[model samples]
Target: MPEAPEADLAGFVRAHDPDRFLCTLFAPAAARPALFALTAFNHELARAREAASNPIAAQIRLQWWRDAVEEAAAGRPARRHEVATPLATAIGAGLLDPAALLAMIEAREAETEEDGLETEQDFVAWLRGTSGGWSAAAGRALGADPEAAEVLRALGAAYGLAGVLRSVPAHAARGRCLLPRDRLAATGLSAESVVATPHAPTVGALAAEMAAEGLEALRGARRDIPRGAVAAALPAVLAARDLMRLAAGREVPAPRGIGDRLAVTLAGLRGRV
Candidate 1:
């Protein structure tokens, strides 16, 4: 039976990140709690800026999580919070690395401070630092070999790019444009234009370019991902699905359904994602 705290953590992930929540179901039962906690911790950090009233408040909130990680690393008690407590448990179980978690938080902090991507390299680096770091940590938690780091990084980059592309409308609505400035400039579209006219021809072209890049990354990683580590890279499947939808000009955020779960399960069984 799942512990109360673990159940709460599972519930949190289910509500905030349904894809990851479903992915956890395929992981080893013993590792499910740790995965849930780790993903929920990600949700907390990713939303810090949006949840805060101001930049300073957001930094403070992120700092709290940083402190909690440090405390756990030092063998001290972590902060008493829903995510932190279970994260501490995962840390204690040797399923999570303190430095990796800290890197994720730092990446999110940088994102909160930056306005938009300046170059393709900048965007890639951001994705590697945030989503790559998260996927790598999940790989470690799933018992992936250290040498699999590169594969996990590639998968994370692909998955991260796809997610950002799918969220264009929502991000634009909030005055945030994730497209590289150079790409936007080449297409004669500004960050404002992306949010203001998301479906414009130029914006659509830029989205397609990004989707192509993401698909290439996904293909590159698929060739190298070990069968034993595929579960950790399950998000790559959803990333592919989303990228395909974007390429087809279909709606990106489809509701989670039995079909989605079965697709993920089949992908997992084949070690394809």
Candidate 2:
């Protein structure tokens, strides 16, 4: 039998994306590798812009991944990178689709071109393609019914927006802001002001508004997701938890503490991520 695709890929995900890594643990054993491979691929795409010194460099990195996906779809040899090799394995196993993977890469590429989101519509669209796409793919890998796709999409959008709101300080430091520009403008705040005074009352209010939007998406997801697809949607719980904290005037909470882990594990056991 072929050697198991490197465990290092899982290790990378566990280190960088602990929340998703935890969710993968609730997946069936046979599905864990594909889930890890998929999330790891997403981790790489999400970091591409920050990993580059300039937009051209970021585009080049994303293009390389695009080419790798195309080659894999065409039955070419897999690339030798930590993430790509396992991704190719997952694709070969028919656990993932090259088209969906390419769409995700394209979404990241679009993000690299924008300094900040210009409107609520733009933010929702971006979240749908990136995070929504990831959740949908996960549901597909788990053999969820076709009808559950839209539910996963809503969950992913809520989860993704909460993540973006939580990362405001880091994004601001990098001269990027993921908050909707028009909303900020209406409040007499701008991307620059957010970066300059992230802890100020105005910025806090903006964060609350964004968090409320995430909560709305989460409500929709809960209503529509079927029981079978709940495991795949577990990350949404983390999103909801964080958004609630933000709404309560707290800084975005950190990774799962002892009590937090217990809560998530209980939720997962009940098929309620």
- The lDDT values for all models are 0.80, 0.81
Q: Give candidate 1's error at residue 126 in angstroms.
A: 1.1
Instruction: Tell me the lDDT of candidate 2.
Output: 0.81
Candidate 2 residues 1-273, lDDT tens each?
233355776788899988888888888888889889999899989988889988888899999899988888888888888888888889988998899899889888766774657887887888988998888888888887666876787788778988887888888788777777888899999888888877788888888877886786676555455665566788788778888877776776575677657766888888766
When summed lDDT is taken over every stretch of 10 residues in candidate 1, the lowest stretch is 220-229
Per-residue CA lDDT of model 1 for 1-273, tens digit only, reads 233476788888999988888777777888888888889999999888878877788899999999999899888976678889889888977889999899889878766665667887888888887878778888888888777865786777777888888788888877678877887888898888898987787777778777976776676654465665666788877878877777766667567567667888998888756
Lowest lDDT 10-mer window, candidate 2?
1-10
- Top of the candidates by lDDT: 2
| Candidate 2: stretches off by over 4 Å | 1-4, 222-228
